[model samples]
Target: MIDMIQQFASCCRAAGLRISTSEILDCFRHLQLIDISDEMQFKTTLRTNFIKNYREQGKFDQLYHLFFHELRTDIEIARSTPLGSLVKDVLENLNQNPTDNPSKSILDFLSGDPIGFLEEIRSIQSEGNEPMQGPIKGPRSNLGSLARRLKIMLQIYAVQESIMNFLAENKSKVSWETNKNLKTYFSQRLDRARRYLHEDPPAYPDNSSHVTSYEKYLTQLGERNFASLTPKEVDEMRIVIAHWVRKLKDTIGLRYSRNNRGIIDVKQTLRDTMKYYGVPLKISYRKRPKRKGKIVTLCDVSGSVWSAARFMLNMLYSLQECFAKVRSFVFVAEMDEVTRIFENNDINEAIDKALKEANISYNADTDYGSAFRNFKRSYMDALNKKTTLIIIGDGRSNYTNPEEDIFDEMREKCRRVVWLNPEPKVFWYTGDSEMRTYEVYCHQIRVCGNLNQLMDFINDLVL
Candidate 1:
């Protein structure tokens, strides 16, 4: 029992759940007090002891489901049926030797110990890949593991082929219902794997440098996904965001302090020494580089991506005091500059006003090709070596021309282009998402769905 618990904990960590040795020990002690035979008590004991907060529960529950239910045998059924032994014997006999092939991992997955399969999927989700080489200007992330998953999916088909062949040769011994049940079991596991491969992982918050407000509700709202909030929570989020703006203002002040000046300005030093009769008693240095307030953002303000964009726009509004120029655009099928709207009103009111007044075609679908084309024609001049162009959207181009060439042009015009994807990494290349194509153009790409991600990105962006 102790060894089983330890192995389960290892799997959880592999799947990116932060479990500690102490939590594992505590879980062992608690299990002694509960009826381990009772599924409810067993699961509750593990979850309560290991999980820290509501936010982590999503991933904790997923791991628990995979470990306890998917991998284990039902007690009554195990006792009544000899099919378990029979199936094991047949699978082991048919299972091929470990070799360097995509089928290798699939075979391990089917051996009923999911650790290998879990590890493979975990690598995909967390982006275990080599860094990009050559003049490729963007990230080298495996791009939601689509290419890898495609291979694994093919391997699954190959395994299914083998399983069917085994069933055919041994049809006399295996009942039709037994064959159906075996196929069903394999299908279910494959389905689970598909979901893990394609769906979003939970938003795991970073508590390293935590921030909170006197209003507990507002703080909680800050932690929640912007899309999940209610109208009441939205109002509370604005209050919390205003607090963040004030904090950033202080950070900006400290950054511009004279004490933070750069390396000594030799030319300025020579000029100052001449003023002092070449005594050279005092020195002059370069002033801190002025804050580049030039912000060009192409925000997708339609569909679910809108929720995160609106909050980001609110934060940008607060930053107007820091930047000399802040230019923003809203887009769906086309784009429109909303800098005037931000300049004219309070940021909070400006958000609501921009949503209504901007030429954002809410009824139309998102088109990155169209949007970037517009940006190139009119707003490309807005970019320079001093500016940071931020693209805030899910990168879902609906199978249209991604126009990655235009992104190359934009990157040339700007110091850096940052892609802030609100969608989770697992869904990066799934469905209509052109994330794989768009990622090649970004100087940096990050998943920014909730407050912690947003806060961390802003901190790195400015300070």
Candidate 2:
């Protein structure tokens, strides 16, 4: 029971609840006040003691069902019936086995009959006799032991079938129902599975520690090394990543400067104008119009860089509020402006459309030269001395023509050109990556991989 409590607490943590050993102890103390024999009383006591929020309550309910739900004895018996006999008989004759077999077997054993099948098997084993091969194990073993093992196997199969059915039925709603941590875990697992099936074989992690929470065990089904991570640890990672994403975008532009000589004080201007309004021939200085800032985002939505593209899109969407003008473009084979998508506040829809319109073949090929040339021709009028051209890509053009001249032309038009590459600087010149070719033309180039790197890059951009 103590182990069960601890397991429940761990599940709560995975569901984004913060639980400690002390809390589990407190729950035990509360359980003492309830009737131990009453299932409902025990459940009520735990819920009242442990769950404090709606989210925790939902998690508690799921854990409770998984732990307490038991299959009926009849169902267990039916499932444990020899698989070979069941399948052959049912498929060939389309007939059900006589239900009296189990009852008669139980009655014969209970009647103290010396002719019982189990007794006969034990007699043979006791005489060092080897039983013939069969689907069901020899009856020399205790029926109770066999039943327990068979029940566990059947339960596992049932749970797996349930999971598949749930996933198939709730494909769209799964995203909404599952928390971010679980989603990340599942997505990573699916990716690993695909990679294992199609690419290089994945190394399995050692499963030495048998004692782990259910969530951790589930994660291990996807990744062996991932078995040690608790739900709390996964949630912590999600929270940390979310914080970094917000911080990175916040730092990605020029800080508002109070000391800009170009910005006129309206109150001071009005005061100066009032002094000259009342009399003789006096001239008043005209107020200067604020200088509008220009922002040009060139993001790579190519197959190889989709993850980075998503993160960059999120950053740019946030930046739309701070900038005067944001011209967003996605590139693969060519560049297409997607500023309107951001304008409408439909980021997911916009990304879907952008991916379709860009027609960038995933992992196929990248033509930076063609993308830049197309951008220059289409949006040349929008480029000016005030414009900041921000390019986000891995810089892997598949050894295609980089067209450094287009970048030079872009540098001539924009105030500053900043290249944000997701790949590490070490890989900049490796393989077919063309980052080195275009790096020379950009005014600023930074490696923006994880959120920490991105935040540092953004801080530099703004400063």
Off by over 4 Å in 2: 1-292, 356-364
Give the Cα-based TM-score of candidate 1 against the true structure.
0.49
Q: Each candidate: what lDDT? A: 0.77, 0.57
Q: Which lDDT tens digits does candidate 2 get at residues 1-463? A: 7766665565455434566778788888888777878988988877776766554565466445533442122223335654323222322221122321222222222121212323333333233334435887663444544454344334333433333443455456434434343334333423332221223112334343443554464444323112233556544434544565477545432333333345445556666666678433333344444454678888887754655565556655655555578788888777777777667756656766666655445444688888878877887777899998888888877777888887798899889988888777888889988877887888888876654565456555444
Candidate 2 is scored at a TM of 0.42
State how far residue 311 of model 2 sits from its true place (Å): 1.3
Which 10-residue span in candidate 1 carries the lowest summed lDDT?
A: 96-105
Top model by TM-score, which number?
Answer: 1
TM-score, one value per model: 0.49, 0.42
lDDT of 1 by residue, 331-442 (tens): 8988899989888898778888777778767788789999989888988888998788999999888888988999899998888899999888999989999989978878
Candidate with top lDDT is 1
Question: How many clashes (backbone N, Cα, C below 3 Å) per candidate?
Answer: 0, 3
